[model samples]
Target: MPRITYIEHDGTEHTVEVGNGLSVMEGARDNDIPGIEADCGGACACATCHVYVDPSWIGKIPAKDDAEADMLDFAAAPTSGASRLACQIRVGDHLDGLIVRMPETQG
Candidate 1:
């Protein structure tokens, strides 16, 4: 398991141990965390699971694919180079200390 920290727009934080191989969106969804909406249920068809990767960990995570990048355009919140769809990121030992922040809203 890897411990991932999800920070809400209002600054609330939830750190939990996520099972290896699960998507980051699953980590938040399974834990009842308030921020990630996951409307498409990890299909990568919706940007509701959007989150901004913490600055330090930005380059460490895998790069986004075309589908993820395309859907992010529909996110209700603004995005930056750090913007990513949680469903596209899988949890693994390499991401044990990963941190992601939720935007103010989701699409």
Candidate 2:
């Protein structure tokens, strides 16, 4: 399992160990973290599972695909280079210390 840290917009932090093969959103959802809404489950159909990858992790995670990039346009906050949909990022040993920060809202 890989341990991931999820930070809320208000500065709350939750760290949990997530098994490999699950998406980052699933990690958050399963841990009962408050930030990521994951409206579309693990599908890339919605942007509700949006989060900003930590700057140190921007180059570590795989780049977001076209569909994920497009869906992010619907995220509540403005998207930047670090913006990513949690559903699109899979958990793995390489991401043991992955960190993500949720935006203020997810509509």
Quote model 1's TM-score.
0.97
Q: Write the per-residue lDDT of candidate 1 for residues 52-88, one digit (tens) a residue.
A: 9999998999999899999999987756789999999
**To one decimal, what is the Cα RMSD in angstroms of model 2 from the true structure?**
0.8
- Going through the candidates in order, what is the number of backbone clashes in each? 0, 0
- Cα error of candidate 1 at position 51, Å: 0.2
The 10 consecutive residues of candidate 2 with the worst lDDT sum are: 73-82
RMSD to the true structure for each prediction, in A, is 0.8, 0.8
lDDT of 2 by residue, 26-94 (tens): 999999999888888978998889999999999999998899989988988756888999999999999
The Cα error of candidate 2 at residue 37, in Å, is: 0.9
TM for candidate 2 is: 0.97
CA-lDDT, candidates in order: 0.93, 0.92
Clashing residue pairs for model 1: none
Candidate 2 stretches with Cα past 4 Å from truth are none
TM-scores of the models, in the given order? 0.97, 0.97
